[model samples]
Structures are given as structure tokens and as C-alpha cells.
Target chain A: MTAVPNGHDGLITARGLYLSFGAIPALVDVDIDLWPGEVLAVVGESGSGKTTLLNVLSGRVAPDAGAVLYTDPEGEQHDVHTMPAPALRTLHRSDWGFVHQDPKQNLRMNVSAGGNVGERLMARGARHYGTIRAEAIDWLTQVEIDADRVDDLPRTFSGGMLQRLQIARTLVTHPRLVFMDEPTGGLDVSVQARLLDLIRTLVARLGIAAVLVTHDIAVARLLAHRIAVMQRGRVVETGLTDQVLDDPQHAYTQLLVSSVLQV
Target chain B: MIRTEGLAKTFTLHLRGGMQLPVFSGIDLTVHSGECVVLSGPSGAGKSTLMRSLYGNYRAGAGHIWIRHHGGMVDIAASEPRIVLAVRRETLVYVSQFLRVVPRVSTLDIVADEPITRGIAPDEARDMAGSLLLRLNIPRRMHGIPPATFSGGEQQRVNVARGFIAAHPILLLDEPTASLDAENRSVVVGMIQEAKARGTAVVAICHDADVRAAIADRLYPLSPAREAA
Candidate 1:
């Protein structure tokens, strides 16, 4: 297991972040930090601005106010909101991973499974075909696919397997930070269980810092070290997973907990 | 009530070629309706092995496990496989610490499978399973995805949902709270209490003192076998 951070390192810090679209606010005065080697889940109902916060923090959407800073491995702080486009793109390609909700959206449909994974490595300047293929196969096996199927097209794989392949492709590059938006969405219960297990193992083994956005409190409780609950584009509560979920202090959080759908 | 007499189990070490490793023997226990019985022991003791034997996952070396089924006592130890499966489906439920994965199956369907098989409408079963997953903290977005990539805590919740949704007459839980956080643990305690109130018989192994204190009616201790020491 990778050495977990001692709750000191701030990999990404956002201060007084504010954003709006066409006069309506999508995020309002939000501040948070992404720590190294920890999973942080941002949870809330749809249109509560959880996704907007993720996009802003990930530099996909620029905020109108506040500053978002990212600390590189060398401890140099870069202003994410104002960073040059090329440098920001480079940062995402080499140091970060993004997993979309749909596997088809995240994976390259035309590429072979191995090619999908190898492409990530190739972007970082891996030139040797034999070495890249070997690494890709190794990663495929790690995601629970047969090594022999490395040459097969992802279109032939099941939805669950496709998601696994996408994960392998994203993580094979050893990205330091991963942003996931409903990574387990669109799968059935049985497949989701196994897939969740796999994702947990990979996240821990890689020591990847993650910001996972989900509407499910259970997903937050399971995967996140800390949770930040958002409502109407503002954070209602933030704390360790157990504390926030078990003894929620905010009225909104309390309602969310008690309102958990029952069978 | 479900009762056992002289329940014993032994494993022949396949690699060691016929050497018998006896787990436990001469065990006597009874679990009555609305009661929770907890098995307590050290790591090497046969608590889990014995629990599995009672659930018919392992063949007991010697004993009679009488389970109340259809207004009669069925000897699970000597019953045919068909009878055992029927009892498992209709009367007994087992929740293990580690989830057994059914490849490419989503988390919702896994939890809903038992209830659906028991004649619940598919939509109702899915809804119930969805609610259970929500209660267990599984995300709604994950309702349709396969479970193979879920974290340990998530997978355990799926397992718990599957076992509880069955609402069988008897429950066998092995470390059901092993991977859960304090919040989810309390949820599990509530589920257990609800099951007991419905007159379900429960046998469980829990090392967490808080959970044990919350649900156990009595403690059954198991010790490692010592050959005539």
C-alpha cells in the first residue's frame, strides 16, 4: 500500500470559488482542498452545483471569482484558473485522470483494449511497442480481464468490462489525481459490487487523490475519506465520512441522512 | 427454535494427504425465534467454520442440525442437497464477510434477485433493492453498474442487502459489520433488531463489542481443538 498522507499535504486548494451561467449561479463561495492519497466525495442532489464545482476545480470550467491552486510534486503552486491552456492540458494529460459516468463516453470506441491503455502511456513518450503492449496487458489483467483479450475491441466487452477497461486505461499512466463523476453509474447491482471493489483496490494501491461526485450517500460513505455535502451551489456540511454521515450536524444533512430511501 | 447436537467438523488436509484437522466437536446450541446468538472465539477457533456448517456450506463431520422448516425439523446435516437448497431459499439466509461476485451483474439486481425469485414483482423488487442500497449508502448512480469494481465496504453492503431482502426465518451472519463504518454499523444493528422483532432466529459472529452488545442475547464460546490435553 502506498503511504497515505498524514492529513497535511494540500494537493489542490480552492478559495472563495464562485461561478455563474447567464446570470444564474452554479457555484457560490465554495472553498475546499484535495489532499494527496485521499478520496474526497462531493455529494448532493442534481443541479445543486456539485458537478459545477468539480468542473471548476478540474479546470474544465473557469470560475468567475476566487482562486484555485494546484500543488505539483515539486511543491510549486500553479494557479489552475489562470494557467496557460497548453500547460493546463499537459497537467491533465500527465498528472491527472478523469472518469466519466458512461464507459462509452470515456473509452475510445475504435481502439483495441490494449491500444486504449497504451495510448495513455504513449502520450507520455513511451516509444517501445513491445514495452507498451506488455504494460497494457499487465494493466488489463489488473482490471480482471484476461491477458489474451488485450487485442480485442472494447465494443465487444460488456458494459461492466468496458468500464474496467476505461479505468485501466486511465490509471495505467499512474496519474496522481483522478476525478470521477458517477464512475459506477449505469451498472446493475451485482456488476457494481465487483466493479466498486476493483476501483477501491486500484485507488488505494495507486495512492491516487480523487474527487468523486455522487448523489448516493452510500457511495460517499464507502469510498471517500472526507465528504463535502453541497446544496444549491453551496456547501452545507463537510467532515470525515463517518462523522458527516453518522452524526450530521447540518439540518440539510440530517434530512438527507434520514430521507435515505428504504426498501 | 433451531437446535444442534454434537455439531462437529473436520478438514482433511489435501496437501498433507489424509491428515485430519479437526475444527470443533461436541457443540450444542439452540437459537429461538426473536433471539440473537453470537459465537465468540479467538482467530484460529472454528467460529466461522461452524457457522458455515450450520448454513450447509460445509458438510458436518458429525452432528444433527435441526432447522424449523414447514412446521417440521429438517436435519440439515444429513439432508439431501435439494432439501438443503430449499431450506436456504425459504427459511435460512447467510451473509458472509466477503461478497461472492456474480460477474457482470449490477448491484441492484444482485440484491433484488432473491426477493424477485420469491415472487415479488420485478419493478417492486428493484425498487425495494434500490431503497435498501440507498439505506446502506450505495449511490443511486451505481444502481445499474456491475459490482465488480466496488470497494470492500460497498461490496459488503451489497451482500447485506441481498441477505436481508430475503427476510428468511433464520439468519447466519459472519462478521457482517466487518467492513462497515460506525454509521453503517448502526444501520446494520437496526436491521438485525427489525429481523428479530419479526421472530427471525439469528446466529452471528461479531468481534466488534459495540455491535455484539447491541444485538446478542447470549454468547457461545468456541475454543480450538486440543487432542485430549
Candidate 2:
């Protein structure tokens, strides 16, 4: 909020956002700027409006007030809420990825893993099934899933493998910006560690910008370049991940960080 | 190569209802190239905090940290996170009291990662990393394992190896030899001397008096801020 980081506009910027679910405020005066290839984590306790903020930023949920501006590759900025539905859908299909906390929400369990991955490329206008299949296999490998498992149905995969398949399906499109809502959540600790490592490597290797929402401070510390601490639908503090985590400046941030003690 | 003016850090513990803990303030410090300045102070005198501030891990509440980065002076306090990270990668390097291990990253790759990111070839970087680890007495078998499984002394040695391998222009070491045996401590002392011989600006906080005596060109004593404030 204080420094604009040399004034190069972010790939996505949401300013002064306010949203309400009838009587309850879900988001209140939240502002965020995510630069290209930078991972920004939104961290707070449950009911901190983190998921609501992500939905609004990704154009899934419309905010009652404020603007979400997205700069396309051509340097043209699109007002996300004002954009036509079809155009925003195209953006979601091409330049943006949304990885849900539950892989089941993102993946079609009936589709084979390979079919799931290739479908995105097909949606992007790839007509040749062979090429799409090759790229799908390649992505499965990238996400550390075996290529031989390509034809297996999602129902056959373990929870961690399903998440990995979902990640492969999302990343097969090479979306420049990813919206990850607890990509490592809901798994055992060991599985979570592996998935986190995979996400870190993939995000770094591709230089994919991400806006990750997690209640886990350790996840933020592991994956984020910047951290925005939220409480009661408001950003209490925002800064470099190491700075905020190690030397928290806000009361809510301090509490959020101090809650996770070193084992 | 490193200069600070009125450098101060105060923590306002928000959970404690905004209780301000002044670590230090009103300080001026400087270290020229090829010099090793040891921060001599008792515990709780903000020695490690100063090291973290220099590395841009903590946002200083007041003052300027003018660092010679990429042949230009940049004040890290005023700079944004992007600029601060750039300064850290290209110019500044730090070895803290503990190794913050990334899960499953091999110890060799951990040390080699610094040079590899800074444009060295991976093969050459790993070779250099291997040699440094060997010199620091890390066994050959330990290189393939992550530092998470390493003992305190072993991990500290890996940290020492990593800090020296890149040969960055500015080095900040916080208790670099804290948990090591006398032999490894002396080995680290020798490495610090070698780093300084190459015109690197080193600022360290070493409580070991013998190690301090061997490497310190000047002792910059930090008085308790509680006394000064």
C-alpha cells in the first residue's frame, strides 16, 4: 500500500474492493497488486474473507464496489467486472488458472487424466488429438505423475495424485496467472510436503504468477514472494513474505504468525 | 561497501496491544571493502537483528542502509521489496545462525544454487560447492541429503559453505561459527580471512572471542538501546 514497486503496473490489480453476502461483509476495502511471475499469498484465519477476496479477484464473484483491472499481454488493461462475460471466459480459459482447494471441484472425475489435460488445449483451439495427447502426457510428467497413468480415471488416483492431476490440467494451458486456493490443503503432512515441493518447482520453472490463499503461514512462507495479512475482510499488513513473517508489523498479522509456533 | 545512518529497529507488538520494543536506534556504522567488522555485544543487544536488517529481511523503522550494489548506492530502507531482493541476490549474502532448509533439496544443490542463479554453469557451480563442502569437512555422502537431517553443527557447516561459495561482494554472518567444533571454527575463520582478502566487505556477529580476535579488523560495539534511548 505504501510503495508501488517502481510503478510498472501489475498483471492484475484489485483496488478498494468491498463485497457483502447479504448482511455479512465478505470483503472490505481490500487492495492488491500482483506482478508478473510473482507469487502473492493471502493468509488469515477462517472467515477472514480470503476465499471471497480470491473469488472477486478472479472475476468469479462480483464485488459490490471497487475495480479489478487486468493487463493483457498486448498491454491493454481490461476492467475485469466491466468486461463482457465471453471475453472474461476467454481470459479464464487462456491467461488465467483457478486451482480449487478440492481437486474434485476443478477436475471431472469421469474423464481420464490425459483427457482432462488435453481438454484445455482443445478448448484453446488445438484440433489435433495427437499433439494434444502429447502435450497432455508432457504435462503429467511435469507434475511428477507417470505418463503411463495418463489413461487412468481420476477416481483411481489418490488424493495427492488427484491434486497433482488437477495441477497438470491447469498448467497444461500455461496460464500466466494462477489462482490457487489452498493447493496443498486437505492432504496428509507428507503428501502436502511433496505437493508443495512440486508446486514450488513448477511455479519457479514456468515463472507463473500466483495469488495463493491459505490459512497455513508455512505455505505462504514456502511459496509466496509477498504476503497480505487479512482479518475481518481487511488487509492489516502487506509486505515481503520474509519481512512480514519474521517481523510482523500489524496486530492481526502478529497474532496470525505467532499462532504457528516452531515445533 | 556497506554504510548505515541512524539505522534503527523497533518492534510494536500488536498482539500485546501495541507495546513498542526498541531494539536499537540512532546508530551509524560503516565497513569498507576488504574489512571485517565484528559486532561485539551481549545477548539481546540486537546483533542478529542488525544482520537481518542488513540482509533486508526486516524493514527498518528509520534510517538509511546505503549499500554498494551493482556499482551504485541503493538505500534498502527506501527501496521496494523487488529492489531489495535484487540487491540481496546480486550484491549481499548472509549466513545466519540456522540453515532454513528447503524440503528435499540436496545439500550440494543448496550451496550450488547461489552461483547457479548468479549465472555460473551448473556443473562448475556444483563442483565448486562440492569442493567447499569438502573443505568445510562435510562428508561426501552428506552432499546428496538435505540439511534437515543434519545435526546443528553439520547444518551450520553447510550454511558456512553456502555463504562462502558465491563470493558475493558483501557478506553478513550472524554467529557463523556458533555450533562448530574448534577445528571447524578455525576452518571458518580461515575462510572469512580468504573472503576479506578478495576485497569483500564482511560484517559479522561472533560471540566466540577467539574467532573474533582472529578475524576482526575492527570491533564495533553496540551498546544496549535501552541505555541510549
Error of 1 at A247 (Å): 0.6
Off by over 4 Å in 1: A1-8, B1-229
Best by DockQ: 2
| All candidates: TM-score of chain A | 0.95, 0.97
lDDT (10s digit) by residue, model 1, range B1-229: 6899999887654334445678899999999999999999998799998888888776678989999998899998887543676798799999998876546668898888788767788899999999999999998999898887899988998999999999899999999999899999999999999999999999999999999999999999999987532
Cα lDDT for residue A72, model 2? 88
Give the local distance difference test score of model 2.
0.90
TM-score of chain A of 1: 0.95
Over B95-142, each residue of candidate 2 has an lDDT whose tens digit, in order, gives 988888568889998899888767788899999999999999998999
Compose the digit string of candidate 2's lDDT tens values, residues A149-249.
99999999999999999999899888999999999888998899889978987897788999999999999998998999999899989988999999988
TM-score per candidate, in order?
0.55, 0.96
Place model 2 in a CAPRI quality band.
medium
Q: lDDT (CA) for every model shown?
A: 0.86, 0.90
User: In candidate 2, how many Å is residue B90 off?
Assistant: 1.3
Q: Which regions in candidate 2 have their CA more than 4 angstroms from the true location? A: A3-8, B119-124, B227-229
